[model samples]
Target chain A: METEKGKTFRYLREKREVSQDAKDRLREFNRAKKEILGALKEKDMTVNELGKKLDRPGHEIMFYLMTLVKYGSVEAGDIDDMDEYFSYKLKK
Target chain B: MSDEIRAASYDALVIGGGIAGGEAALDLANNGYKVLLVEKDLSIGGKMILLSKVFPTLDCAACITTPKVSEISRHPGITVFTGAEVTSIEKKGEREFETAVTKRPRYVVEEDCTACQLCEEVCPVVVHDEYQYRLVGRKAAFIPFSIASPRVAAIDIENCTLCGACEKACPPKCIDFTQETEKYIIKTGTVIVATGFKLFDPLKIPRYGYGVYKNVLTSMEMERQLAPTRPFNTILRPGDGKMPDRIAYVLCTGSRDDTIGNPVCSQICCMYSLKQAQLLMGALPMADVTIYYINIRSFGKGFEEFYEQAKGMGISFVKGKVGKITETETGNLILRYEDINENRVMEEEHDMVVLAVGVLPNTDPLSFFRNGELKADQFSFVDQAEVLSSPARTSVKGVFVAGTASGPMDIPDSILSAGAASSEAISYLKQ
Candidate 1:
């Protein structure tokens, strides 16, 4: 339920007109975010492992992982046995 | 939110919200003068708050900044306006100036916000966090930093999708998309310009491979990594998240170079790079740290001693100019330099490279005045015509300049400069 103040504020806001390109980009980002979360739910994995699983580049996977980490949807664990990558796990 | 300041006349208006401006405002307010402080950013603590530690002292930058930020906020004589810009200044009388200021909307009411971060947590958009030097991502609805004064959340309207998730998640329902830019007229007796500098972009030097190389970073980006609120658990190269065993610092990246159109010394790069080297040695005991410089300027209080201390800790200082940096296949960087003492071209390999970029003079003061323009020196900083007698006196009679607004200086010097500016402004008001 929206508070009266919030409802009035929303009514006063100018309707945002999002472009088709921006919508498409948001959809793509949402898709990637969902895929990353689903994959991380199974088990903890390094960025390399997640990239391999998703068939994405390591840097792209790293970006989403870090974003998720910041938002508290994901957590980063200790460095892997190879001492190269930090493992990511979904925060329950 | 300083609501009473809307139609107010003040004794002083201090532009910029960095350490210098904070000090100036505090000084004027303590002297029984009403003040209005304007900061263009969402929060007031400027570049000083973004730093990790100061050179020679190694004091936590936040330790010095947070207290001042709070003091400025609590002072009854000073009213602060964050996320606000002065549009124009017209001189009406000898000491009175009519200034028009525009306050940008944060999209969240400051009084209603609890800073609980629930809105930030629910925000879907992720953008480069400017506070973290873009090394990590921050939500579109975010608090600027952990220790940000006012501790309020602001919406990055540029990146915000207007998804309304934050509105739904907010407990106090503080999210307000209806807020628009508000304008106010302020009449002040005197003005102090303390707007600080912007760092040089390393991308200008193509040979350095700053943007093209994954492991190469600017001094500020490295500073963010060393900060307590750092993105990563440890200081690791961004390329592959690998620990860099060997790190190199290239001094005078954009300053002291004729090609970059900035031919003045930045005045603090040498000591700051030395400070970072010492910090890196403490953080990574096994790592080998090296600094390449054309000349080492350690001519400040305890600065030469700090340099000697860094050297005593086994940090290598190479007297050379790094000509170019080439990246290898495995992500190691090769530095090509002319070793001055050895009289030969030399090459070295390191896992990471940090470019100690310079600072440029901000030319914002020129546009602040509409009647008679505030003048700038040849290098474009606020002109100090009476630097010998009064370093803070500008070309304008009632307008003064503080801190790096005039030229390049270290933190201690900036504080001293602010004190001088405050004293001059007080005298001008008394007249």
Candidate 2:
């Protein structure tokens, strides 16, 4: 006989736990990483300029840039703003 | 590593692997009693190891917990089990009990698997990591963290695509596609409940804008920032990563609120928020930090001094309860609160806001005991016989409680409570 409700554990795992949003965002992150690396290889740019170039939020672009910076693939150069925000460049 | 369901016996069985459980196990082991330490999580250091530093003293938290974890693991008398849960426990004889425990498969063999993280690197599937509060990504095949005891990776079977990518990439070939859940019958003289607390999810209060606004963070999230192995380069606003000069902390987010059904005061939030505020003074000197609270609780020793120190450092303390948080167009947060001292409603805008989250008892599977269930109060914290003398004794004989398993407590209190539990268990065994 069928139960009153579907098994919660299985239901949550199949429906609630699986999110298409995460997979989409991960894909977008990969694309952004490639674009950021390509753009920086051409010329150094501030976070705002890169955001404008990519047509994305400055904050979103900075998140990707920070990961690269941590891995030594990207470097935050001299402070270029009153807020101590820096221009970033691909490490040569 | 053998999964044979053999009936084993021990002098003591510690039900958790957190600070309290670890302490109990070590105490019993040091006292010449064979002990079995079980943890439901992939690793056993518990929530304390995830934190940046301790309160009042500002000592590195990892420095204190790491040595204890390492010692517990190396102790000859303690048998450690991760990815395990106690299913049923029954009293068989005088001061002797039989416990049925089930061990979930980690997919990676602990004996053969090295913590190389190579399989993690190769695994194609990426998901939100809960250990990092879902702020980062983890592969399907992964360990809890770098310093995890046993340091073995587990497969998220729910998400595993069975692509065989991780299997092929393994140097030692520890990944097993076909693994079954293993159960064991453990007989022990005494049992200690030390399962810890879980943080209150702030999303419950939609007005606070935790999940809705990227700028709003939980105190646990902020702790990751102050940690030695920080989540980012420095403490920056999550919304735009522009260093936030103005930050506000909303104290008692989930506690003392009948609306959330948790009316008890979470004892640790007040001191931890103060600790973070002091840390921010050193981490970001120019930043202005303010804490909004219903009341400041400095009940523990030296806690009052710590609060005074933060106030002296010019960290603003407003005795107010925040009613709502609305995100500005520029990703800032405006906290609407009632300032009790001024006797007026006030609104303050800041670059970022942190919610001082509360804690709730987290008994795994909600309930563990069946026939002789230990009595718990309205808050789900195991009811203590007496707070002064019999702090560890439960209604069930040969069963004791420690750490947040019994109630909300600080680290020192948890350790003291663990000692009480160990002593009680020792006395029970002697009888």
Candidate 3:
């Protein structure tokens, strides 16, 4: 019952058909996810801290954090310092 | 449900899906009232969701908003109408009001469309990403933002090529460009207008050279840069991708300007500019941040403390009024303003400048009410029945106001106003 425009939009949105490109991106995404998990496995850190630890940008770390948070891989904790940042930790 | 059933069943309707609207709807729903939440945008998180952090508290804007948005979505007592607006409202049967709601096509079917975001990748059309405050580009067919409610994609049909590329690319074949605009009628016992406010366009003041100077950006744009999901990885000058080492914030860009007809001060700009300044320090550790202001009004709870904290953190506070801004050949902005304490004119160059734009009432109640039953004040904000005490009750019976729809205030006040609106509506229904 979806419209043709919507089907095409979703198809391109998922980008599932781009075999090589999709595989490469998926691999990169998994690599970032593994780095995040490994970093958090040792200590709870803020997004900025994790970004620094993993040699990634804060924005990019945030994207991964949201996904990890969504999938129960991470849990955001209390404000770190006077509300300037929120510390995050791996879910037990 | 059929049109007849959809038209006549709600205890209350909250217009807008911002923090205020979300709070009001949740409050009303918890009180056993069926509430219809209408949002003009495709998603419900509102402008606050697009922000990096809130003032004073510095809590993640998305962290606080997304939960309420999700609750509103899952609440049994609430119904959300996205991509819709109230066309008209009229009193019927003495206490009940009948409202006409018009909705634009989603292009992609909401229920069928999953927010895979791949549709955006395949689309050839590129446009200014308004969600990022035009700081970046987005595909014409896209979800509004990362945490968009329902996580569905909506097409910008006007700019869409309609070449059927999106249709062919979709997995569920959910891309439907054939949807038409629809209108429906709903009856509610009471109403809460949380229409929110729009930021004053910095382009209005030519001196700041907002649009003319590439490095002169608005505070919202800077906030976007600090946002977790930003277009750029680091703080960079918009003119070129070079990282800016020196940044200046010009406070009161649009507020308290008699020439611009916005004499009333925008209450939150000072604190927000400071917040962004503090955030810039975190984003670019080596960058020097300076704030030039005619006055620093830190009126809210813990705001003065937050101001002191910023100063302690090494942000330079200049007591002056910026007179003019001109760009150098190297794309640095030259600020000419009188330093009050020094009693002298000073010229400073910064790699980038941020204009702390003011907020203006975004809604005209008269447009939705022909009889002028629901009213607005001289400033065009919906008039509160009791400005000194009651923050929500409007001039008309069974109608209320909340958030920036009434006047300029911060997030906490907006949420409090929303609660007050809910209390008034719940009481009205009981009576």
Candidate 4:
């Protein structure tokens, strides 16, 4: 049941000498990204809103959101009524 | 492309791929001389390409640089090496300079990459985008910029986790994790050092609250937001993505101050700040813009007129020196300064403050010479032996310095400096 992507990932893991620290950090980061995506799947939210919901800094949330937007995993919509923050949602 | 560079000897070796290096390379190549240009960065267009617009003219920066980048790339006589560093340069004989350079690995094969950006989408790591002044994030696999001359993607191997997502996603299958750094030795008749200046770190001035305050951004950061390919949909402050109602500019953040050790004026800051102010007026018409400066040094051609025009556009030019900045609870900034005109201290609150940070000598180019060190001025800029008559002549006979390598200058002056360096290099090559 090892797919092509999983096989390639395993091969790379064996080839490169990745540190345990780095692996752990990546695991944590992936978890955060999953949380953000899961939240966005439920509803469109501003960076501040996501920050409050996830208990992370607004700036940190913005960085993740923008990265997601860049990769087409997320889409930024119109600014709020107060013309302050742009709402981000899961890509259609 | 690197094959061609490795096989042939060049007539001239131009260090740095900024405006000056590109001009010098083009100038030498146009005169039927073979030239090799090396840039340490991922792309040829240096600080100029990152800018919003040029001062006094207000012409689109990309419009000017894209054609030059294209011309340089397509030029038959010039062989360019991007993502390359000149490891060492030593005189082999009386006429030739032997330079050892290493081309850093771009994990993605340059020739095969179609810039499809699929690899970028699959890469999970999110890192600060230096091109956007860290205002945004970029994937480990990235295209340097929209108008990158080669239009190739490079992997930030340092940040890449060896996840194989990019390799799997790349249609061209150009992603090769096993790729190693390439080394080459180039023999050239003459050398032109045009390695550009680095922006002074505003973080060095602790009182300015650069890193402390989310709203206090460097001038280059603001310039990124003003650029055509801005990070955000609009000009929103980084702290909370709010449209700033009032923005303040603090000029000379790290330059012309004896206390910080750099006492010389960065000639381009005043004009560039004014240019940004004008652009901001167009971008955010309802917003109020104010600039605080010790002096408005507008010495370039039509620079004085440009300053007056900015004033005419209702931009408030306050004659003051901002000493410190502090952030409010709501992410707004309060600038504490001495108002020279009023002869008293003043406090001004604004949604954002941009530190007009100065330029410093890169000095990395000077370290590359193995035989003898190129002489540098007190401030670490490459020194000119005869600045009046021969501004391009470095202490090393066959080696010349141009653009901000010699001293800080505007784009036009940098081009003229490149011309002088190329002309000097040509003369040296003939001898």
Candidate 5:
């Protein structure tokens, strides 16, 4: 829950139609996304390989990978029924 | 040694000891002309010496100007009247002009003022130093700056408040408040009005909140704050006394605005803003600096390189016009600007904001001369004959102007125009 000051800040920010917190978060996310994308572009990698390189848990990496795939942020090869991992590359 | 009025004559009289006047005096004296350079300040080094560095090359401005100060001081044909004011200029003959100049009482004898600062140490009264852009206070009898050329102290009579502590502390007993002002009549072949320029007062803008907000500062104020000898010597917000994590620079505050009646672009403001941003980054390596500019005018040689260097130094160059700057409840600056590329209004908050204020003609020169002798535009000095022509000539044959007295110009242009004015003065004298 937002505090009273945070609520006031939000109300004023909304009246001005400018979101400082949102902008800051978006900037941070964009920076992290760019670093991850650049690493993927450098060489093709499996999910485990990318997770280890990015210093993220396999599940968290899979979440971002799934979101990127949904948004067309990355491309993935077809996964065989018995395949143990998924390979991905950055969308140009 | 006697307290008597002295009458002197010179080939040329330079009314100001700024870049324009200093350069003019040097050139004229070097070319075998007897010159009298009168400066109201206690030293020959003018406003340029107070600056941290010049644009384009980022060369130390003091290093570039101190040599000229020394040259003018050592010139055989040049006599510098520091702490003096030109009262009146009367054209006597076809080519001769008589000027009445008044020298202010220094209180302390120039020869005996060893700059030991003993008088300053014991002086009870402290006054805002106009030379340092009022960023710091000085003793009632104190030198203007650390690099004051003559190394002599000045007596702020207005703020003296009759505190005689400085007089009592003087070891050589040189402090004498009884020193009276003396006037001199100088007959000169020509007069050069190199009164230079004055920075636009940021209070007029109101949006930048310069005078209103403690953290919001003018470019000149920022220069003093960035100086090594600044009172704080750190890039901290004046309001919160905290190092600013993010800084914003608003360009064209008073220049290029038809609303304010200043339509010309202050040519040096853009580059100087970049220079200031670079300097701020150096002082606070972790701070983020954003420069809001309409158009970066990189016309001078190596100017584009300097701009590129600024970008490489991680200074953000946002191509936008700042509309308003407001202080948040947290004492941060909320800058509203239009992102030109995105065509969207962007608002960013910063710890401090600096308004890149423009330069205007020094208005004193207009009041100093007689009515029909010199004509100036609405901004102050006489209008330029043409764009390329030197903007240093007045309507009167023997009178000339230099530096931003004509229009907005950089230091190099001012110095170049000063040299041109000197040649024009020399030619007028010969004719």
Candidate 6:
């Protein structure tokens, strides 16, 4: 059974009609993530290398990389072997 | 020859010279009681003067506060001591307090300083201005700001570097580096603690990436940047100095968060965020502004109207809790939040982000009361012990607290609390 408080979060989205805007904004965000991942592949660089090259905050860069994984632009398995400092490239 | 320096006494001592203190002092003095108003800064106008504009009405904050500052300074019954701090407070008798205050040396005589700013031009050392939220620089010897009441220049001995340029350039020849700090003991029947709250440091929330990302700024920092005389006079990214096409404001950054231990709604964040959005729209007109908030509490008069006006101005309000804020590849902000209405997780990108950080009580007052006569709830406010009474009383008999010292109140609520505190003090005196 759905909990009483948990239902509010579920109903809130439906009532607010955030589907259209959320879908569009998320799509745009994901597109940028894929492009960044593609650029990393072209440069043969890891996430850490891209972070240093782009001068982006590490957590932010990592979050972007995670977005790539969510969008299937970067393989999840590759994230394991990628060095924390030099992990940017996605493996097929 | 009489060697004794005569001492003066007052009915009430008001600490801080901000809106609440000014109002309290005025209210007490108008009631025919002598009031001593002490301010730690060189001028009587407190943080209220630093604001570009106030919320709801969007009135010029300086214009509203400067008049009160002038009135407090000129009132015969109200004596203002700028550049002073309460060193200690002791109970002299039943319902009486003796407060020891220390006055810092201004280096330049107040009457002769003239605010010519000539000393600033010749001063060699430049230091970050604390009054401008450190977004701008000031000379080693300088007036705090353009509208600083009783305009006078002060020397920053810490950053002076002892370069004698200000001393040599002083047309009034008022620079005195060796001016000793003076102490005074004053007795009063009542004390009103109006030391206002401080903005929460956004650095604590690493996910927002405040310090790490130059484009992200706290609400107060945004105010300084929006000021007409601000260094840039434009809302540009600190990292690259580019005007952002889109901006996002994360509401309740520190407040309404059980994890941060500040669960109460900050009371003013919603309205102030709306004000900031309106200001941004006026500046750029085409720039996109979005506010992420869990709930918009427009409980005050004209507050709901202001919120509706922000909506009419095309400012978007997303009912969500921003889970994390990260910077994108293009130096834009990536805000991840769960859309409660959509039943899905979503993220948006914007060029700059502002965190509407909440306020916390000034911790300095606790040092003065030994018996814990003053107490703050979990939210760090000294409100009344019961619901029936005014929310300005302390455990101590004749001492009271007002403004944000009581809780996160807006300008109107702060004024009301100041008036309430004055009445409470008057009643205490009667008893």
Q: Write the per-residue lDDT of candidate 4 for residues B1-431, one digit (tens) a residue.
A: 23434544789999999999999999999999999999999999889988989989999999999999999999999999999999889887756888989888787778898999888877777778999888888877789888887889988866778778888888877876655678788888999999999899988899988877778889999998999898876787777667888999999888999898899899989999999999999998988999999999998789999999999999998899998888888889888989998999999999999899998999897788764578888889999999999999998889999899998899999999999999999998888
State the iRMSD of every prediction, in order shown.
3.0, 8.9, 10.2, 4.0, 27.8, 25.2
Clashes of 5: 0
Better of 2 and 5 by TM-score: 2
lDDT score of residue A21 within candidate 5: 47
Give one digit per residue, the lDDT tens place, for model 3 in B1-431: 12331356699989999999999999999989999999999999778988999989999998998888999999999999999889999887545989999888787778888787778767655555788776555666788888989689887765665546666678887876556677889889998999999899988898889877867888888888898887655675655445677899999988999899898899999999999999999887878999999999999899999999999999999999999999897778899999999999999999889999999988655578877877788887888878887768888888888799999999999999999999989999999
Q: What's the number of clashes in each of the models? A: 0, 0, 21, 0, 0, 10
Worst 10 residues of 2 chain B by lDDT: B363-372
Model 4: lDDT of residue A8: 46
Q: Which regions of candidate 2 are displaced past 4 Å?
A: A1-80, A84-92, B1-4
Docking quality (DockQ) of candidate 4: 0.35
Compare the candidates by DockQ and give the number of the best one. 1
Q: For candidate 5 chain B, which ten residues in a row score worst on lDDT? A: B232-241
Q: Assess every candidate by TM-score.
A: 0.94, 0.89, 0.82, 0.94, 0.79, 0.80
Considering chain A alone, what is the TM-score of candidate 1? 0.79
**TM-score of the A-chain for all models:** 0.79, 0.68, 0.77, 0.77, 0.63, 0.47
**Model 4 clashing residue pairs (backbone):** none
DockQ of 1: 0.39
Q: After superposition, how far is residue B306 of candidate 6 from its true place, in Å?
A: 1.3
lDDT of 5 at B257: 92
**What TM-score results for chain B in every one of the models?**
0.98, 0.96, 0.97, 0.97, 0.95, 0.95
Show pairs that collide, candidate 2.
none
Give lDDT: candidate 4, residue B393.
95
lDDT (tens digit, per residue) of candidate 1 on B1-431: 33534677999999999999999999999999999999999888899898889999999999999999999999999999999998888888888988889899888889889999998887777766888877777888899999998799998877777777888888898988777778889999999999999889998999999978878989998998898888766787776566778999999999999998999999999999999999999888888999999999999999999999999999998999999999997778999999999999999999999999998998887788875478899999999989899889998888899999999999999999999999999999888
In candidate 2, chain A reaches a TM of 0.68
DockQ of 3: 0.08
lDDT per residue for candidate 2 within B1-431, as digits (tens), equals: 45588689999999999999999999999999999999999988899988999999999998999999999999999999998999988878778888999898787778888888777777766555667665545677888777778778888866655555777777887876545688899999999989888889999999999878888999998998888866566787766666778899999999999999899999999999999998988988999999999889999899999999999999999999999999888788999999999999999999889999999878562366776467886788887867677999887888999899888899999999999999999999998
